[model samples]
Target: MDWNERYSEPGFTYGTEPNEFVAAVAGRIPPGRILSLAEGEGRNAVYLASRGYQVTGVDGSEVGLRKAQELAAERGVAITTIHADLSTFEIEAEQWDGIIASYCHLPSAIRAPLFRAAVRGLKTGGVFVLEAFSKEQLNYGTGGPQSPDMLMALDELKLELAGLDFVHAVTVERDVREGSKHTGLASVVQLFAVKR
Candidate 1:
């Protein structure tokens, strides 16, 4: 899909609210330099920057990033942004205090390496927080990719991120209301881990 074209529309595809899971875990994360992966339109990045964290948003869409910059300006916060696809993005070693993967789902071939890169990108003791649609989301009729390959599984996450010390990892059916794109009861996996 052409994400840039999709984001070329007049408004944000997903509303301005940070993901619920990200909001819920905000307090547990000390404000620091954080990297947000597949950060579509910068809502989560802006939210973290508002909370005093230096946030950098990375996404593939230039139009989406421009919108994100607009949103950040509208909200009176600053966030660094990178327009690059996660598929080939190189994360620097020990560069971030925290990394957020909000709704960042990809096929195993892509996601697995991305997970490993995220680990290598974090500072020692850095935290990695993620919230994504689970495989069962196909039945939710709410949001996310229909292909099973694009959906996330908790077991897959565990296997991909085996080096981290898990703080919270669970799969559940929950209410997810974002923009028109994501709404209603949804199946998801939420993971929070710290690099030991």
Candidate 2:
């Protein structure tokens, strides 16, 4: 199935609220321009917008982007969205205060360049938050890309973000409720880091 089709079902795939980990640190994230990677249906983007953050959401699927806008309207928040393939999207340097990559799954080969772009997109001291499935997720059959190459662990993220200052990085098992697709005990790596 197409990426948008995977997310374009009747309900939100990851729910209509900000992620719990995101909510926990929401207070610390100073309001400013924010970019959300692979923002399927815009739950986090809309939530951030509601909290006074200027959010820019990017995704490849128009179907998903439209749903994201709908969610923003339903919540009475404003968010900027762009439909573009992250694989080749050129993220401007020093352009954002914060970036969020929540459950973005891609082959490692594809992930590297995209991740590098995510890092480069941030200004110095800008924060980047990521919560994604670990390879161990294959055991749980939870909500994540089934491909092992698409999953990640702390060690991998450490290597991928070699130059960043890590505020938090750990593998945690948590109950995730994101629409009907991402729910259950998810083995995830949560990282809060900043560019040097």
Candidate 3:
């Protein structure tokens, strides 16, 4: 997907509001540096910054990151933005108090290593929060990658994120109203895990 082109459009592709799950789970994360992966437009990062977490948002699209910075500025909060692809973006070990991967869908080759790095990147007791479309989402057509390989499975994630002590993990159909792209009832996997 040409994220740059998508983001280059008039408004935020996923809206300016943080994901509902992210907002709901933010209080569980320790207050400190937070890393946001595939952070397309900085809604979540900006929201976290507003809550006093030092946020760093990383994304593949320069246009998206630019808009993210603008959003942060508009919100009167500061957040670092990094433009890099997930395949090559390095998640420094023991560097984050929290890490978020909301709606970040990628093929297994990239997703596997990225998820492993996310596990290693957190400090002990640091939390990892993720909410993404599940394989069942293909039937919903609300949003997310069309390819099944890009959709996540709860069991698969459990194996991929082995070191974390899961606080919550499940796949269910829920209403996801997020901008123009994602709307209506959708199938998704939500997870909140603490690094052991």
Best TM-score among the predictions, by candidate number: 3
Instruction: State the lDDT of candidate 2 residue by residue for 1-196, as single tens digits.
Output: 3978877678877788878887777766656999999998888899899889999999998988999999999999899999998878888988988989888887888788878877888888788899888888888887788888899988878877677799898898888877787779989889999887
Candidate 1 residues lying further than 4 Å off, grouped into runs, are none
RMSD of each: 0.9, 1.2, 0.6
Where does candidate 3 clash, by residue pair? none
The candidate with the higher TM-score, 1 or 3, is 3
lDDT order, best first, reads 3, 1, 2
Query: Which ranges of candidate 2 are over 4 A from the true structure?
Result: none
Candidate with more favorable, higher TM-score: 1 or 2:
1
TM-score of each: 0.97, 0.95, 0.99
Lowest summed-lDDT stretch of 10 residues in model 2? 22-31
> Global lDDT of each model?
0.91, 0.85, 0.95
Question: In model 3, how large is the Cα lDDT of residue 138?
Answer: 95
Tens-digit lDDT track of model 1 for 1-196: 7889888877778899899999899877756899999998999999999999999999999998998899999999999999998889999999899999999977889999999999998888899999999999999899999999989988889989878999999999999989878889999999999998
The TM-score between candidate 3 and the true structure equals: 0.99
Best by lDDT: 3
